[model samples]
Target: MTGAASISRLVKKSFLGAYLEDALTLFEAGSFLAVIHQPDAYALAGTAGPAAHEDLLQRFADGVIPAPHTRELAVEGVVFGWLVLDTPSHAEASALDFVARSLREIISRELLRRGLGAETLEQYREVALLQRAVGKLNGSLDVYQVAHSLLDECMATSFPADHALVLFLDDASRTYRIVQSAGSRELPYAERIAQSRLFSEVLANACWDDADGEDTLASERMVKGEIVNDLTRDPRWDVDVPEVSRMLIVPLATSRIIHGALVMASGPSSRPFGSGHLKQTTTLATVTGIAMANAHHFHQVQRILMSLIQSIATAIDSRDTLTSGHSQRVARIAHSLARAVSQDRREFPDFAFTEMELQEIFYAGLLHDVGKIGVREEVLTKATRLHPRKLELIGMRLELWGAMHQREWTDLFERLQAINSAYDVSEEDEALLYRLANKSIAIGEATIEVLSADELSEFLTPRGNLNAEEWEEIKRHPAESHRILENIPFTSHFPRILQIIVQHHERLDGSGYPAGLEGDELLLQSRILAVADVYDSLRRDRHYKKALSQEMALAILEQEGRLNKLDARVVRVLTGALESVEHAEAPEPRAFGLGSPVDHP
Candidate 1:
């Protein structure tokens, strides 16, 4: 309700009406009560006995009859109207004075009650605003994003100003940079604000005084915040803008350390910031400081974790001389492919990876072969069908056979050597190996088979260097990789890292090893890693097979995609990315190996 209407209602409910009527009856005097409402007045209550007396009361209310015997009706020394009476005897005058005093006290009490109610309502509003700001500011762990949210909450809530800035302290440079801003004035990106002596003094006073000696006054001033009512006269107004008439500067700090400062300002025409603004700004700045500190600590931990992961991957790669730097290369390629896939709207319209998810993919790529650490060094670096020691033993057995049988086994030995090192053993070579395995040489002391059962099995293998047993051992690395990684805590930020690593060797058609997981069971990150692993393996020369050209390697990948052994969309994305690289004159593809090339004989 309007203020005047509320006051009128209060006056009617008070003793003004009853007291005036009692005075008229007691003294036979004409009396009335009227309330002043700006330029005019109106009678609230009066005597009821005579029409002529009532007519005189109305004329006095209208100012037609002179108010010569008027007593001012006021509360807190401010008059609202008058209590007027016709000439009365001495006894009636004293009674009327007491009634007037009682009426004034009632009006004063009512006004005080109304003010308290308004203040309570304002407190509730402030509480609600603070609750909302807390939620918004604490929602993110990114320091830069939290800074932006801090400024946004300040301008959008009860503490709105004509200008707002969130500045962060650069520890290395010992300077403040405007990280986020909102106002009519355009702020340059990362603009450095000079710290004047007054500005530094206020900041030092507002924050914790870290001196060794105890000073009660300094301790009291710590974290109380600052309010500059007149920027024109204050030396602490370091901002170049002169039009800002007032500012509230609060340090974004926690108990541990100070991160930066928050500055909120008003233009000359805007309302000056007071203690209320300082209280609200300090509350928001405190929440922002805690959030920024958490983000800073989180990023620090991430850097340390990444460094440890890289070292482990390097150790794994270094174990096998032939595949040195393989893990690092796969990580780069997988990260690149993931970026490509994220941008391929037509192929992956609903699949967009966040920065953390992309980091997970990169980490998975780097540590995909961690299980190789558990495998024997010889098996990891084996370049031929048989190990060197076993090959040497076989050659000695052949020489003993040739001497005992009185026949030259020179051509047969050379053919056996060819079969052992060949990328693919022909059917003719397999038959020769079978014949050799069945034969034996007899001597005076003992009888020894020319080729043992295990040797024949490894020599007759049709593809790559590893035989059936070694191939089984090689396949265990994926599950082994999972076993090693599951013990570590990777579920928080990189929840999919373990899954991606274990599934990198899996295929869409259930042809791949370890679990034979098919189709939709695989993650997109796993598919990306699979493509990168195979691509890098094909492009690098291994002990058994020569490196393939970029075109040939891609052709092999496309064939595998058609066979349902790899994700087609991921393959296409890699192809597009490589084409772009070629057009851009990227450096030559480096040599790195994962293992035996995928789908190669």
Candidate 2:
């Protein structure tokens, strides 16, 4: 009765079934290998024999196989599988049946040897599937599916669990409840167990303090046991442990936050699971925990990016006093318009973005004017209608004229004092001198405007007025703004934003300067920014120009959009947002935030 025969084309099944069929066959050594259609699948399961059984049994008894490994049957969700060797009565057996049992022991031990080998392969396959699922868990929506599927696969194929249930720890309920379930009818009790002291203490409350796996699991059994804990502690639990008996619970956490716990269990058919069984189930629970943590981390990454963009916007305010906070206002208005467009059925019926995309857009809007940082303060905050050197030039001429008159005035003062003790220029005389000086300064400035730099230098050398050399300095601010933006960090990652900032002043009719890109050549963001920049500049408070009312600003934008320089859709979005903003700001008798407006469809 050799048991090494092979068969062709065998279908795979629960980890144990395939092993039993493979190890029970008998045949010629080499010929047996080819008998099975898929012999290779179970080729690793060893042949049956008494010696083989004894070897594995000794390995398990001495703890070489380990408690968790010894009870691996429970881990795979197999309700029960007794390792009946030819001879064994320690746990309890009849003395008269010992010899017959010994013969069976040899066969059973050989079966276990075969089964353990097959289990090793099956376990590795299960883990491989889990690793693959982990690699694919990049999106939030897929997380729930992958996690549930991982557990189900392990149960249905490995342990043949008719049902699988996952319970997430609900802090609010102070208990555990089924987040996902697909097994038995009594799964809802998982929620009821949330308030159980044993569950709260071992799995949720204090499992972390214990270092030993056995101690932690033993504590869980007290909470999860059907006869011992459930019968006495949970009167609500059905008298029979039909739905749940052996359970595996593992803590779920990452380096940053402890999200919750994962709970896996087998019903009444699978109670008193050994240590190895508990360990395997806990490992599966850990994988689910990591998937949840990854989703959390993705959101954190989004927050960090948003904060960096806001910091850049703040930098602009600190650098220029007159134009401080210009970028922030743009972000608000642009975001408002973006929301209007995003929510508008006419524009984007199904267009939706994660909060993170909107955050990214907001940062782009705020840093739109960061390039202005490179513009000189004199250029950015030009005090007068003209340039800085304009005023300085006047003072220089006035001083020189006073110097020339000093010598003659000194001689005249001495002579005048000799004739009269106290006589000075009369009010009329002083007024006449001041008038002549200002009149001469005006003539110099006007003439300086028409003169070339070289020609003006000749005039300044003679101590006459040329012109304020500052207006030219102020006009170059746009170029300075471009240079400043060229050096911005993360430009490659956000080039569209950089382009919009630099080309904001460009018009659609090729009337704008710099690159002279016209029409569709400009990005959508640039077109939107162009319209927004113009409107904001006209409506917002500025030192260089009077603030135009919203009505007037809208009129100007309407003309621009009509001419096709700026996008028409953007104009519509802006119009909607502006109205929304006004309504939001209008202290409607009882409102504190934007009013909810639902769509008919």
Candidate 3:
């Protein structure tokens, strides 16, 4: 045997060490090589009877045999050790190195064959990152918070790395700073300056700039082998430390542009970087880049949505100067109450929607009253307890009645004058007339304070023969809101939420208003909106009434809950969220990534 044969013998020896019985049985079963189950794992002459042996011999006549890499192939009553290794493909047998390469290739092909390619794995990883970011966002989980979490995962996965830094490219479009860091890395102000310059000069310029496109590679200011690693070095590694000098800088790029970068380094004990390793690093970078971009994008989208919502809330407040802070105040209370329920580990298992979802809910609450924009101002701003036009009509009728009373009194006074008792009769009649006028004034005054919206509209409408023509008004504000929203293209994608806005006034007991939806018939968002809207209305100063204190507003809601007006559990959430909103400030979105610093009114 030559060197090749010796190598083959060594391979076979190690193979047998792991599976002696398998090799021996295959050698023994070569006699029966026909009509065997080819893929069976445990087939050999030792396991078969005489009659099956004949079938194995018949299969041996054909050129095919057991697969080379995997055995246990059955030839009726026999198995073979690699199916005789004989090949009719004379072309393949002619090359020695070709055969070795073929074997190596087979092992590498397994993952691809199983549908787990490098790209596929990377995709799965991206999805996982997206899920985490979204969860944090929904939990009102901060964007940087999610990045820190991802860094923790990375650190936990790679133990020996003494340092790590994750930077998110915020909207300044030129700057990216330390989002999360661990170990001895002294983040340099210079690096951030350089990073900004690079982003502005390279990434920002390359992306969306007419000269650069998706194919543009991000330019690193401190290029991996030089500037950055030196600045962020571990104190223990000295110049004599040739053992600890490996650096890996991988640019995280995606379909659109260069999203970010991941820098991984190790001191001496770490293996030298190789092509395979570079590919792995690049893969991770690409994934991280896409994730950062997506997280940033998702957050901005939320803020954009919130801004629109807040604008609506602000608009509602602006309409009634007295109730300027109403909706926002409600949102604050509701969110605070919700956190109270969600923060405690004993009671809060896991908030399902996450930070972003909570924000969406908060935004929706602020916009719930936007539809009231369509309501008539006279009705909304009605003061002194009576509708303006109806009060004028009442005044005219009273004047006519007073005229009739005066005529009768004058007649009685004349009759008394004739009997010389007119003065006494006139005095009694005067008193009686004064009492009737006072009684009428008291009725109008009493009803004005407690009269509800619908009741006010009814009472003011001249009733009976004395009033004007038949009076009626459509009272469903939700449907009206839906109609109004249906016309605003800015809120197109949010149709369901718009619907919730419309139906927000609905009651679970079918006693609320408008649609009167019950139980699950109402959306969770709508349920949350109901409490927030109600709270804001109560807390904010209004045209017709005074703003109640936060505590008083909450008490009103609690009472409404017992009465089965608003959902009890939802009110509980709002009550808990009260302080969160009161002291709660929306994080300046501009600070994170928006083009400018977001200013709140």
Candidate 4:
């Protein structure tokens, strides 16, 4: 039954029945009172009425009932039923007319109450749907992720579209492309629609050229969202997806700028899109647009920050010509090694790096040598045990000594040159240097030792060119890097960047400098960086050592692994990765950025 008819029956049974019976009592016996509903012709007979309910309905249907006092029952200009009374005199008829007016007023109030209740329920449903859309969109900061979430929301129960597509604007291209889609329809049709002039005009808030040559401002439709009930008949519908019978178009925008458009379509068998669908989709688009805007701004800031970081790394590497591009190579190698480790689950059962963690590792590798900026250039570039000027002064002193003593000291000068340039000084050479240290020379009334204490200490060095003080300064770089990075704020996003960079030089054994961190005290990211740093350092030539071949470099890394100075699993992974690339049919592996060897030695 219709709601109005049902309300009419309920009022008669609950209140009108008793009033009609009392009104009949005010008249003589055999008085009749009945209510005939308009929708179903249902009759309710009063207790004092002589006619039965079914007979009254039959009489009304047959049009054979006697004419009686009649009052129309209606509410808000909509007729529900009629109240009929048959009495003996004018007094009883007048009293029945008063009763009929009172009954009409009661029915009207009940109908109004029912209408308000339904309106309130619909409002509650709409609020709940909006809350759910906001929750889903707020879960991620990635723009693509937000787009996917938006499509999912459109296909949800509240919106119920057969197909949905989210198109985002590419600022550089000045066109829109579908980023996310749903349902069985192929993407070519939607893609064409996204790039069409209709979507462009909608997003740009410009005039749309109708198929009949009429101009319609698309922005007007976009203000509250648009619904095209029949795509075949709509003048603006150009792209043909056979299954789509109707569609809703809403712009994904905020007050500042429009980012894209959201298009939802229904198939031939599904319900057509309506004004309610347009309202819900529009609200969803607004929430998604705000999320996308925030994500875009965040990524822009991230790009700027990354550019600044790369510039700093370049400056650090440029200080010494031999170490040029060293930081970038280390970063690439470290990132590759981390990826390898993550794939080898058996070896590192508890270790796996997420994409964010891998990025942190790469950044750490780039800034690993940032502390070198604080070191003096002369000390950093030192390649010999003795300074050139010191050697020259010694040569002049020896020449003076030869002239004063009337003897040639050419053999001693030559021996000094050999000792200064040799990679390793033999016992015989050390004894010769000791004897030279004890000798003295007098020139212009000034007596000076043949080798000063500092000079003697530097010349007798057993390995590499750096002296004791210079080596100490070089070792302080990692700590200096830590101090410099400590001043910057990177803890929020890259929480472990400082930890990874400071510990890159550390070893599994306690032989590393600075903190002397060992074994479990180190992070897996730090271990990956350490292996990369050593591998690159071995492959590239420095002032003290010649560049090693790839085979030789891997062998040295393996040896370090065996000695417990590096992570054996990580070293093995790097070895396997390099070997796999070599045997494969792809182009020669350039991922590590390995360049031709330089012969510094």
Root-mean-square deviation of each candidate, in angstroms?
Answer: 39.7, 38.7, 34.5, 41.0
Cα displacement (angstroms), candidate 4, residue 354, comes to 1.7
TM-score for predicted model 2 compared with the true structure? 0.33
Error of 3 at 491 (Å): 9.9
Model 4 scores worst on lDDT over the 10 consecutive residues at 586-595
Better of 1 and 2 by lDDT: 1
For each candidate in the order shown, give its overall lDDT on alpha carbons.
Answer: 0.71, 0.46, 0.46, 0.72
Which is superior by lDDT, 2 or 4? Answer: 4
In model 3, which runs have C-alpha deviations exceeding 4 angstroms?
1-309, 344-351, 406-457, 460-475, 484-496, 573-577, 587-601
What TM-score does structure 4 among the candidates reach?
0.45
Q: Using Cα atoms with residue i matched to residue i, what is each candidate's TM-score against the true structure? A: 0.46, 0.33, 0.36, 0.45
Model 4 Cα RMSD, Å? 41.0
TM-score, ranked from best to worst:
1, 4, 3, 2
Q: Give the per-residue lDDT digits (tens) of candidate 1, residues 400-496.
A: 8888888888889889888888999898998898889988987778788999998988887888899887789989999988876564445466778
What are the per-residue Cα lDDT tens digits for candidate 4 across 308-382?
Answer: 555566666766667877988888888877877888877787878886677677778877987886689888777
lDDT measured at residue 426 in model 3 versus the true structure, 0 to 100: 41
Error of 1 at 418 (Å): 1.4
TM-score, structure 3 vs. true: 0.36
In the range 421-472, model 3's lDDT, one tens digit per residue, is 1112245544433443343323444532222333224333322111122211
What ranking emerges by lDDT with the best candidate at the front? 4, 1, 2, 3
Which structure is stronger by lDDT: 3 or 4?
Answer: 4
lDDT of 3: 0.46
